[model samples]
Target chain A: MRTEAGPPVTVVVGAGLVGASIGHALTGAGWRVHLVDAVPSHAMVAAGLGAGTAEPAEPSEVGLVVVAVPPRTIADVVGESLQTYPYATVTDVGSVKAGVLDALWERPVDLTRYVGSHPMAGSHHSGPVTADGDLFVDRTWVVTPHRKSAEASTARVVELVRACRARLVTLDVDDHDAAVARVSHLPHLVSVLMAGHLTDVPEEDLVLAGQGLRDVTRIAGGDPGLWQQIVRANATAVLRELRQVAVSLDRLITAVETAPTDEAPADLSLSRELERGVDGTRRIPGKHGSAAVPYEQVVVAIPDEPGALARLFGDVEAAGVNVEDIAIEHDASRQVGYLTLSVQPERAEGLAVVMRDGGWTVV
Target chain B: MRTEAGPPVTVVVGAGLVGASIGHALTGAGWRVHLVDAVPSHAMVAAGLGAGTAEPAEPSEVGLVVVAVPPRTIADVVGESLQTYPYATVTDVGSVKAGVLDALWERPVDLTRYVGSHPMAGSHHSGPVTADGDLFVDRTWVVTPHRKSAEASTARVVELVRACRARLVTLDVDDHDAAVARVSHLPHLVSVLMAGHLTDVPEEDLVLAGQGLRDVTRIAGGDPGLWQQIVRANATAVLRELRQVAVSLDRLITAVETAPTDEAPADLSLSRELERGVDGTRRIPGKHGSAAVPYEQVVVAIPDEPGALARLFGDVEAAGVNVEDIAIEHDASRQVGYLTLSVQPERAEGLAVVMRDGGWTVV
Candidate 1:
């Protein structure tokens, strides 16, 4: 059995968000990392952008190889690497596992040293410009190991994921596609559809679109090329889920058209619909595989200044409060900002009371 | 012209999230607030739940009455209110306007004393229990008036909204409905459709749902009764937008099915699709009717403890930087938490540098 000792040698392919992040994480953990990309200039980009690297060499020299290329290119990149160097246990960080696995099936490579992976972590921003070393520090990293995948190889990949401070989740290729379709892919489609509708709005009317719309449709602004590949790869499941959404929307249309009156239903009221929304939403995973955490709010008044919020936070800290999440709204005309602090449930009321006593206009 | 003093006597009907919040806001601003509802027991429940009082005599002497009842009942309530009580300027806060305006059209009362308003602020959390005195602060409160509405009556309602510290936008009834359909109703439909898809998930699989899914579908958990009223009231525009969304989703589905392999069209890649998504998303209005603010993230490491996060905030403040938004993630098993601070563009790098130098791990 190989002993877990000093930093392992990790090689990450593709100098983008996923790849660089892996390298950055491994390097931060004291690992000897060699990042590779098809573009020779990628080594410099990756190193300078902070994921770390060197020239690619024999795979046998490294403990693991993480393929972080595009979905369309993942198979080719993994296959090529395996063809040239055969000793390292290889894994991939592709969004769609089945497609990559299917493409790699016919390749003349060692089957034992290969595993399929997808770290369910991303940002609204993309490419190296948005690269950060801690991108996967506390996110879920999914590993899809087929029946033929060697146990040792799977364990090694899981170790690498854990070393990067990510929670490990095991699944089959098909299940991964289906699960991600429901959670990630379907949301993107919904966002895109809503965003497409906005295009039809008259410019003047469109100007009134607010935070609610922006928050709901935020994911619409994703990389189209990348999303096309993901949707195409996972089309069957995405389409199946999209059909379900269509049916739900159709029922809503019918119900709205036939409502007893314009007033909300007395019993099933809008609250019930919203409750269902909340229930389903809670089923989502939270920080590092924990259950989803709902937001709790605390309203604080802030003066208009460069560091007003920093001062408010400092004041909240002085009052012995821990803020879990925060949202800020500024009224430029009034020259003030409303800071909404989302804390743990038990702490919310206490913090609010404390902030109130602290005299920062705790709203 | 009349000289205005401090707060006016205000009456709120229904005592729900909207009504109670209005009452609380008005009362906080030094107004004599009279809250009324159909059920006497509801008043106790409302006040106990944080909504406010429901005294009948309060409306008898008030200068303005805000009917916060459901859309369907607004017409009957407003019609009766206008004929029954002739002393005060009258207003109603309903999602839809055309119906309410139609109900009031033939009333043998002073139309000059009536104005219609809808505050574009709400919570998935309903009723008096979640009533916040500052709920409308910094949010848009749309004031819709008929062509014959008296300027003084309109000003009265506008003053109330202003006192609540909300931004005011004046529009005709039809314009309000159309605007809300694009910004509010359509988003609700999309959220509901997406959340309803959760019904199809295998129970075991859904237990693994994560924050991304919850974020996109959170609004789906809205009050079905309120949504029903809202959708029915704005049926035409909601249906039109839904059809538009359906068409766009269908196109996306088609693209997924027929897009070429590695030879994908220039704009068909997922990355490209996501880029378009971002572009369209940026079009939504943000604070001050400006472009939506995108965050610059600063990830910091915190120890797991009650006062750890508070202390971090203290240090963040000492760094002399303002945090625009914040998200925290705690890895229980690891005994550490990752706190992400969203700061203005120029401050992120400087703050990160300072936090790191201050002996804290800033990623």
Candidate 2:
């Protein structure tokens, strides 16, 4: 630990994934971190599991307090924290920024010691057990500083992101919400709706589902409580994006309805439309944080059964290749399926050779 | 392998995933199967890849021809095959039945030997590579027998499905398209549109994506050619479902845009409207084709590195527990993260033990 200054005292509220994570990262950065959760024993539950521990918080002793509770409860928590810890600078890591801003509007606090921040990052998993110290590395952390926010406070938050090795994105509260609504919130809702379809399916039929269904409906399994709060909090912007999606869907429906008969020479138009939709959608990066450079895929063939996937990944790791994305295709009839791994373009050739040498089939 | 009597020969045309799977299954069922594909190499590829293959075709030598090809091309391929091999009973595995029916509208053929079929099973993958003998096992195989269709032909097709271990779903051409449009086509289009949004994202942000983004956008990587054909062939039904989804989306937008502020609690009416949409959508089945069963989750803490997930899964598997779903929550600020796995009600306790015994932190 850096002794130049007895570690910077950092405080995190909530023992959820976000809060625990912030605490872990700060501790790794030589910061003396204290965690606080609304539930009295929450911090202890987390700390005993090796995630980290929260020290009994005192208002004046902590230099910074981060509120990482659910969106619906963020404002109340932030406000209480600000009032309770008068000397500490306050910040929040909420999904929606404008909601927090609006909630804090009436509660006049020392604005100079507060800044609004959101990291455009998360896993589908949640809570303290999943918190990691390096989760923010190379991720985007948005800093929404109000005009009333003190420059020192803003810098402190920026420094917090830097300490975690995360990139900084600055935007106003509304813009941040809108952008997230487009990138994250809308996607969540769409996935939920899609997965909800499976809710009524006959149990036997779902067994036939392939990787596509698995991938498309993955987010549907998210924490309903957390999602309820997120969607409700960012309802306006999320719905706006939903409407945009609705427009495209409507157009697609219209085209499908009026499509020519299969015998007609020009009947390929609908196919073209569907193709357009697909082409438009592949712009998403699979695993790499950098969307600009798409990861290169190398498909590996493996047999179906236990330990097959585990061993394949083990080989990838053994070869010192980082797999950015992985897709598995398995059908028992063939007894063999292919696994597509997206690796850095520069590493693909080397990774393929190493994997093949490890007694795996690379396609 | 059953030597009591040789099963009737089955010839499957087109040799795609569905067609090949049917052939593979039939061959496995003691049937002398003959598979054909226009692209002369298709049979070889399909068989070599373990999807299916043909034992040299003699004119009218097989009992049935299962045409499994793209919707736009199915009609032409089936028509030609029907003419070329007049004695073979024939059926097709196309998504859009209406288009194929319309294509054969006035064609004079042995209707007694032909029954239209659509197996409501597929993968995001395409072609012979993804074909498997078990693809149709326990899945629904819709058989649309025409008015003039021979009872014997329908029986043969039904027998074909039975051999594949798939359940029978009887429906006419139009109804099948409409139902599938609702369940499959519309959802796929939605996935594409959402994934397409990230195409323009800068390279920097792409690398930061986690399992959530991957899950939501996975289907976006599907082959455009196959999807285009599907959307075009089943345009009418797809369009209908898209309209229904649009209505739901519109209502959601209205509710959110008009949401009450702090002065008034969010309008319960709007929330109800959104809930209705959610309820209607959730009627879809969950995993294993079962009815949508709402589950409560327990997240487990796990380390952030290689073999963590593997060890976790190995323990869960060793406990003889089936996992409904698995999700990983990664926090950028923390180096640790949690993995949330969905399991059946009866298996949750057992799974917790498996994790605990495996030295994992299950919360």
DockQ for each model: 0.40, 0.27
Tens-place lDDT per residue, model 1, A301-360, is: 677555565556666777666665555654323345667777787777887777777776
Interface RMSD after interface superposition, each candidate: 3.7, 5.1
Q: Write the per-residue lDDT of candidate 2 for residues B243-319, one digit (tens) a residue.
A: 65676667666766775667777566454543543554455455445555755465776665655655665666577
Query: How many clashes (backbone N, Cα, C below 3 Å) per candidate?
Result: 46, 54
How far off is residue B197 in model 1, in Å? 1.3
Cα lDDT, model 2, residue A344: 78
- Name the candidate that leads on lDDT: 1
CAPRI classification of candidate 1: acceptable
The local lDDT score (0 to 100) that residue B346 gets in candidate 1 is: 82
